[model samples]
Target: MASKYRRGFDITRDSLRVFTREPSLILLPVLSLLAVGSAFAVLTAIVFQQGLVESLVTNDLYQYGALFCAIAISSSVATFFNAAVVHCAAQLFDGNPTSVRDGLAAAWRARRQIAVWAVVAATLGTVLYILDEKFGVVGSLTRAVFNLAWALLTFFIVPVIVLDERRSLRRQLRRSGSLFRDTWGESVSATLGVSFVFLLVALPGVALGAVGFFVLDGILATGALVSGGVIIVAAIVGSQTASAIVRTALYRYATTGEGVGPFENRDPDTVFPES
Candidate 1:
């Protein structure tokens, strides 16, 4: 138990150190959220203002098409910013300084590939949605299995998109899968470490929020709730940034046999071992 906590602490500390060194890294995820939220808002407006709700409900083809568009819009936005984050981390890990602009530029350079990937992901997502919505318990079970497989297979796709040479999406998928097959253990461990650390950070705020919502009253409750919300949001951003850093470092190490940024001076085996 103690060792587990220590490992989490070490991973969290290192990831945070990288973030402190490159504070602009936070902007990528923030931009992703804003863009995705806007896309969702537009879709909602179209549904309500344009009277697509009934069409969306009754027409299978139209409903699927709309869902596909919604998924593609949100997924593409998120993926593009993720590519930006990966690109920035790539530079940072290489001992070069970077900015939000540089990261955005890198992602833009790969815009076509990212769009193709978004379409691929959205198609699969739509099929899964249809399955779960139309097929009952068997569809739910199949969706769960397929979703897990999809996540594992595409684990390194963002960094691969940013860093790999222009290749077909199938090739990129193979590359990601190959890398995962080689480093799955270390990757999973480091991700869990980051998650565990952030969970610890989030718990106090969660408790405070629960208290404010249930056990407290009036201004005291409002203050507690607000405080908790801030803490939780900060924790979320921190975790997202930290997780990205970890993924980038692991990708760099797996592909190039070298660590970058926070993993620079430490033995890769100490944190992210080769298996």
Candidate 2:
């Protein structure tokens, strides 16, 4: 059937259905982690090779703080790219016939945008930190608002960047802003839902970590690697799942002007609504 909707993204009930049907589809997150492992390895090497950590450990508190700040900035960049890749991966789960390689390539293609977002995020964070440091006026509240903004920005940043939309960042941001205008509540809820699942998965690991610390009198961290790995994996799952949900919804919403109201048994054809 012919449709008037633009060929873009929409969040929908069927999107979540796709995620639920194949929760393991989040394994894309794990693959993402592995793909970025070399980056981590390189960072580790830099820290050791340059004796930065050693210098920080031997120096005053401010030096340690500088090291941590650098790490935070770098991690934020990695996170933006990772989220973009997960967005692509979610497209595949939504039946877009996209592969992990394609997702990675797409992520690379959109690297500049992701990097720009990272800088924006970092600047916001730094501002928050500075405010907290200088005045200490409602610092927590300030940080919370900043974080919420960041989260909302993340909701459609990747999808907008990935879609073959020919628009300036201002226009993309405007469109993404419009898409989430009345739906921030739903976005936060969906985020919490996925996060809760990861928490459930990580509970055992948390318990193990606590027990290991107590049992070893803080001498040995039993299951350190295992538990850490599990926590990391859970993080990956949550991220990928959220990406899948958001992209699917965006794709649907863009096409049909519908929020994925509720999950219903749906075929790709029904879920997508002919465009």
Output the TM-score of candidate 2: 0.68
**93-155 in candidate 1: lDDT tens per residue?**
677999999999999999998999999999999999999999999999999999999988988
Span of 10 residues, lowest total lDDT, candidate 2: 1-10
Please list the C-alpha lDDT of all candidates, in the order they appear: 0.84, 0.55
**TM-scores for every predicted model:** 0.87, 0.68
Error (Å) of candidate 1 at residue 180 is 0.8
Per-candidate total of colliding backbone pairs = 0, 14
Candidate 2: stretches off by over 4 Å: 1-27, 35-41, 54-94, 164-167, 216-221, 224-228, 258-275
Rate residue 82 of model 2 by lDDT. 55
Candidate 1: which stretches are off by over 4 Å?
54-63, 204-227, 270-275
